[model samples]
Target chain A: MEAKLLLQDHIAKTASITDEQFDYVYSHFKPLFFKKGQTIIISGDKVDCEYFVVSGCLKAFFINDEIKMYILQFAMPTWWTSDYSALYNQTKATINIDCITDAEVLCLSNDDREKLCKEFHQVEHFFRWRTNKGYIASQKRLLSFMNNNVKIRYEELLALYPQLYNLVPKHLIAAYLGVSRETLSRLYASH
Target chain B: MEAKLLLQDHIAKTASITDEQFDYVYSHFKPLFFKKGQTIIISGDKVDCEYFVVSGCLKAFFINDEIKMYILQFAMPTWWTSDYSALYNQTKATINIDCITDAEVLCLSNDDREKLCKEFHQVEHFFRWRTNKGYIASQKRLLSFMNNNVKIRYEELLALYPQLYNLVPKHLIAAYLGVSRETLSRLYASH
Candidate 1:
């Protein structure tokens, strides 16, 4: 299926919009291709775009004083990725996003996305619902961290996104799961 | 100021609505009163209402198997509180919200809020903007938890909500900061 079709499918699940409206929505975000290991965005760079991952993988991380990168998001096919704080604030990003695999992603600049949102209520509605989903997921994640054991968390993660193992690197996945890579490996081997 | 004026102020922050539209928005939520230490919504109960605090404080928490309650939100005046998972799914709540002070809140049901969103695009816009604020705050918090020392985090907490110290119990404030009471008291004394 085409990336535009997939984007439309995702939008349709949340709100109804006509083909003409969808076309307008599609126009706001341009397609950007990247080779594996390419940095799409870096810390202190001005954020001009939010990428919609049509295929392949992108990882966003921040390096702390310990010189370790803490992964914040891993974008796979059908996921959206960006330095959201920078995207919203129009400031330099403290985090960096890199293509971890050769990727084709739909990109939308801040101004164009805002224009699209203002142009059509459908577009705004779609984004509103998307934000809702992200909010609930993140809240549930914090709750999981506070309450669930590692094994239980792993089970819940699997139940929520079955394809995560195949799409993401194990260590990166482990980091996202808030567990050490060794523990993740042991868990995988044991199960 | 009256509750209606506060509603206008809240909506006016993002978008302007006509008097009629404001009235329509206002009709969805009924005014409610809560005493300190009152349990507004318990886990496993049908969460039919989302409260908007006009004054005072409220906290949301989940009780673990060890019976430890982990605080989620410490809502002050002008804040919105809801068990959103249940609000979206119409299921029993997974978290309990309790008033931490005598509070006057406006309660809106999921159905009414949905209808308002569908009928009034302006209302949708307001909520979209509100949700985005929550999203940005959460991202900052997640990063802070990973990188910031407890003292620094405590300082940031106070900087963000200075009134919290006098308005709420130190222990509850500590819980919201994701620290212990002793730690917070020490930080408070040192600072």
Candidate 2:
């Protein structure tokens, strides 16, 4: 699918806009490609753009002092990814975003998004719903983590990203679940 | 401060509106009062509104199968709280909201909020930035949970809610930090 159509379709789910308006919105996005294992945004870097995934997968993650990584989000097709804290607050990124698979993404700069939102009510509506959905998902994830039920968490993970098991490597999935590779293997075997 | 003025000031931080426009926006919010320990929305109820805190505090929380409770957020002055997943997706609430102290709040029904957003571009912009800030806060909380540093998490909690220590009881503070009363005591001693 064309990246522009993909974004237009995603935006259409939340807000209605004419073809001409979509074209104007699409013009603000710059397309970018990355190879598998490539870093998109690194910790401490200044982040100014948020990416809309068109193909493949990306992970936003953090590494603690012990050097253990925790996956924050897996951005698949139509999913957005960024060190949003850094992007929105104009601060150094505390998390890194990198490609889990060779990827194509449409990048929208912070300035362009604000400009587009100011220019079009529907565009503003689309972004508001986008963040609302994101906030809900983050809260859900937080609840699951607080509950500390691995089985339930695994099921919720699969329900959120059914394609994840096939598209992502086992170790990466383990990182996302915050489980040991051995524990993930046990869960996999049981499944 | 008057509840209307409080809301007006909060909205003015992110948006510009005339007195007439502010009056129109203020009309959408219904004032509500609750005593300490009063429930606002319980688990499994249909959630139709989100609250803006004018005075006192509220907690959004969940109880697991073992009946252990986990605090998701504490909504203080100028903060908003709802079972956002249920509110946005029109699902049954999975979390409960209740007052920590006798409280005054301005409630905005979901439909009214959406209507206001459609009627005013600045309202849409205000809500987009509102959710943007919320998403960032939720993401930060999730990261803190994943890192599992009790001292750091305690410090972050304090920084996020400075008045909480004096207002909320010790046990509820422990619940928010996901620590035991004894551990909270140790941390307090160390502090």
Candidate 3:
């Protein structure tokens, strides 16, 4: 499916929008491509756009303690990823986004999103609803991390992403699960 | 401030509302109270509603494999707390929300919240936007846990809540930081 069709499907799931409304929404997002290992946004730089991933994968990572690197997000197809606070707050980015595979994405600049919001009421509401869903999912995952067992969490990951094991690297998945690489390997072996 | 006034201020900050709309929105939430240590929602229990903190505090926690408690959220004044998936998905709750202090809250049944959404366009949009913010912050924190050092995380928490130390217990704060209580104590003392 084309990107617009996916965007429309996402909108229809939440709220109704006319063809004109969809046009206004589409106008703002510029299509872009990135090669693997491309840095979409580097830490300490201003981030004015949020990328909507149409294809391929990306990872958000940052340096810690002068010796270690930590992965924050692994953006899969259909997922939106960015230094969100930096984009919203218009501050220097705190995280770096790197394409893990060659990618096709819709880049929605903060300026264009704001303009669309002002020009179209549905656009504003559409984004609001989108953000809310994200928030709910975020809270759920955080709570699960604190509450659920590793085995349970692993099961959830499988349920949520039936093909995730093959799509992403095991070590990165381990980092996302907040487990040691060895533990993840053992979990994989046990299964 | 009175709970109604607080609710009004919170709503007005995001979107302009008619006085009638305000009253309509307020009426959907019925005031409820809970004493300290009360279990608001238990694991394996049905979750039919969500609570908005009008006064006091609560912690949402669950038991891990080692029979240790891991806190997912510390809901203070003006915050909304619940096992939202159980409430939204009509599933059994995985976490228990317990009062950390004598609490007063505005309770909204899932049915009532849906009705509110159907009746008022703005209310639905407002909540959606709030949800997005929540999602962003949650994912950001999850990433921080994956990437940032405990010191950086603690410092960010301090900046976010300058007086939270005095307001909340250190153990819960440590849990929120994804750190051990002993580590938090050392970090606090060093700072």
Candidate 4:
């Protein structure tokens, strides 16, 4: 699907906007593509733009003090990803985002998002609705982590991203579930 | 402090609104009070309104399949609490919210929030900014959990809610840290 159409479809679900308004809104986004293993944002760098995944997969991950990698999220088509804490606060990124596969994304800068929200009421509503969903998903993720049930976590991950098994490597999925690769393999075999 | 004043001040930081608009927005919120240990939202019930704390503390929590308690968030004064997933999706609550101390809150129904956002662009902007902060906080919380260091989690919790130590009970804090009471006590003594 075209990036514009994907984004338009996403925004339309929450807020009503005319064709001209959508064109104006879409103009603020810059299309970018990355090959597999390409880093989009890295820890210690300043983050300005957030990506809307148009194709392929990307992982938002963090490295702990011990240098252990933890996958925070996987961005698939129509999903958004960013080191948002760094973007909103103008702080250095504490997380990294990279392509899991060759990916195309629409990048929207912080300034352009704010401008669009100010310019269009529907845009503001769409953003609010978008963030609400993100917050809820994050909260659910937190709850699952606190529960510390790896099997349930594995199931939830598959449910969230059904295409993930084929698209994402087992080790990456293990990192996302906070389980060992062997454990993920066991879970995979069981499923 | 008055609920309206607290809310108006909070909104002012993110958005600009006329006094008339502020008053109109304020009218939608209904003030309610709860005693210490009172339940506001119970798991399995329909969730409608989200509570903005005027005074005292509240906990948003979950009881796992094993019936173990996990604290998701502490809603202090000026903080909002709700089973947001349920409220947004119109599903039965999967988490419960309760007053940790005698508390006052201004409740805003989901319908009224939508109405307010539609009526005022600034209100919409305020909510978008509000949810953006929430999404960031939730993401940070998830990251901290993924890091899985109790000592660091304890420090971060204190840093987030400085007055929480004097106000909240120790066991609840332990629950938030996903640690046992003894471990929290050891961390407390070490600090």
Candidate 5:
């Protein structure tokens, strides 16, 4: 499917908009492609745009002082990814986003997003709904981490991205669960 | 300050609205008061409204199957609280919200919020910006949890809620940090 249709379908699920309105909204997005292992965002770099994945996968992650990596999110098709804190607040990115596989995405700049939202009330409604879902997912993830039930967390990880296992490496999955590679192996064995 | 004034001020920071519009928005919010220890929401309850704090504190939390409590958020004055996953999705609450102190709040039903957003473009923009901030904060908390540096988490907690130490009990604070009471005491001693 084309990137424009993908985005339009995603937005239509949340907000009702005419084709002309969607075209106006779509005009603001710039399509970009990335090869596997390509870095889209790096820590300490200015982040101005967020990507809506049209195909393939990308990971938003951070590396601590000890060089331990933690995956914050995986952007599959139709999922949005960015160092949103940096993008929204105009701060330097503290996390990096990179393609896990060769990927295509529609990139929307912060300024353009705000402008579109202002121009179209439905656009604002769509974004509010989008952010609301993101907030709930993040909160749920935080709760899962705090709950410390590895079994439940593993189940949730699978439920969140059933296709992820084939696409992403085990080590990255371990990082995402905040568990050791050994622990992840044990969980996989049990599964 | 009145609940109306508080909400108006908070909305003004993110959006522009005429006094009449503000009044219309304010009308949708029904004022409610709660005594300390009173539960506003519980797991499995149908969640209908989201509260905007006028004064006092509230905690949004979950109790695991082991009966261990984890505090997901502390909603201070000017903050909002609800089982948002339930509120937005029209599902049973998986989390609980309760007052930590005698509190006054303005509650907006999910339907009224949607109605107001549809009626006013600026109202939708305000909510979009509001949810955007919440999404960022939740993501940051998840990153902090994954990083697993207690000292850094403690500092970040303080930065997030300056008056938290004075207001909330130690055990609850420990739960919020996903640490034991002894560990919390040690962190306090170091501070």
Candidate 6:
């Protein structure tokens, strides 16, 4: 699908926007492509834009003091990803985002997003709806982590992103679940 | 401060609304009081409204199958809490919210919120900004959890909610940090 149509469809799900309005909103987005493993945002760099995935996948992740990488989110097609904390707070990124596979994304600057939202009530509604969903997903993930039931977490993750099994590397999946590679293998075998 | 003023000030920080608009927006909220330990939402009950804390604190939490509680959020004055997934999706609550101390809250039903957002662009912007902050905080908490740095998590928690030390019980604090009471005591002593 074209980036324009994909974004239009995604936005249409939450907000009612005419073609003219969507075109004006979409004009602010710059389409960009990344090769697999290409970094989008690096820790300590200033974050200015958030990417709306048009094709392929990207991972927003963190590496703690021990150098162990933890996957915070996998941005699949039509999904948005960024170091949002950094973007909103106007601070340096504390997390990194990179492509999981060669990907195409529509990049929207923070300023333009605010401008569009201010200009269009529907755009504001669309973003509020988007953030609400993100907040819910994050809350759900937190509960899943605290539950400490690996089997259930594994099941929930797969249910939420069924294509992940084949699309994402096993090690990355393990990191997302905070499980050992061996443990992930066991879950995979049982399934 | 009164509930209306408190909520109005919070909104003003992110949005510009005329006094008439603010009052009209505020009219939909139903103020309710809860005694300490009073439950607001229970697992399996349908959630309809989200609460904005006017005074006192509330805990939004979940209990796993084994019956261990994990505090997802501590809703302080000016903060919002609900089983948002259930409230937004119109599903049964998977979490519970209760007063940690005697509390006053302004409840806005999902219908009212959507109606207000549709009617007021500033209200939509205010909510989008609010949810963006919530989403960021939740993501940061998830990172702190995955980092497994208990000391950092403890510091961050206290920094974020300095009043919580005097207001909330030690056990609940421990649950929020995902630590044992003994560890919490050690953190307290170290502080």
lDDT of each: 0.82, 0.95, 0.78, 0.93, 0.93, 0.94
Q: Please list the residue runs of candidate 2 whose C-alpha ends up more than 4 Å from where it truly belongs after superposition.
A: none
Please compute DockQ, using alpha carbons, for every candidate against the native two-chain complex: 0.61, 0.94, 0.56, 0.92, 0.92, 0.94
**Candidate 5 ranges beyond 4 A from true positions:** none
Write down the TM-score of every candidate: 0.95, 0.99, 0.88, 0.98, 0.98, 0.99
Alpha-carbon lDDT of model 6: 0.94
Task: Indicate whether candidate 3 or candidate 6 has the larger TM-score.
Answer: 6
Error of 6 at B13 (Å): 1.2
Candidate 3 lDDT, A1-191, residue by residue in tens: 68888777877776677888788778778889999989999999989899888888898877665545666667777778888878876789988898878998999998887677656566666776567556666766676676646777777777766767888888777766777799888889988
Q: What digit string (tens of lDDT, one per residue) describes model 1 on residues A91-157?
A: 8998989987899999988888778777778777888888887777667777776674788778887
Q: Where does model 6 sit among the CAPRI classes?
A: high
CA error at residue A80 for candidate 6, angstroms? 0.3
Specify the poorest-scoring 10-residue window by lDDT in model 2 chain B: B171-180
Interface RMSD per candidate: 1.6, 0.5, 2.8, 0.6, 0.6, 0.5
> What's each prediction's clash count?
0, 0, 5, 0, 0, 0
RMSD of 5: 1.0
Cα lDDT tens digits for candidate 1, B51-85:
88898889988877777777777887788888887
TM-score of 3: 0.88
- Per-residue C-alpha lDDT of model 2 across residues A88-108, encoded as one tens digit per residue: 999999999999999999999
Q: Return whichever of 2 and 3 wins on lDDT.
A: 2
Candidate 5 global CA lDDT score: 0.93
TM-score of chain B of each: 0.93, 0.99, 0.93, 0.98, 0.99, 0.98
Worst 10 residues of 4 chain A by lDDT: A182-191
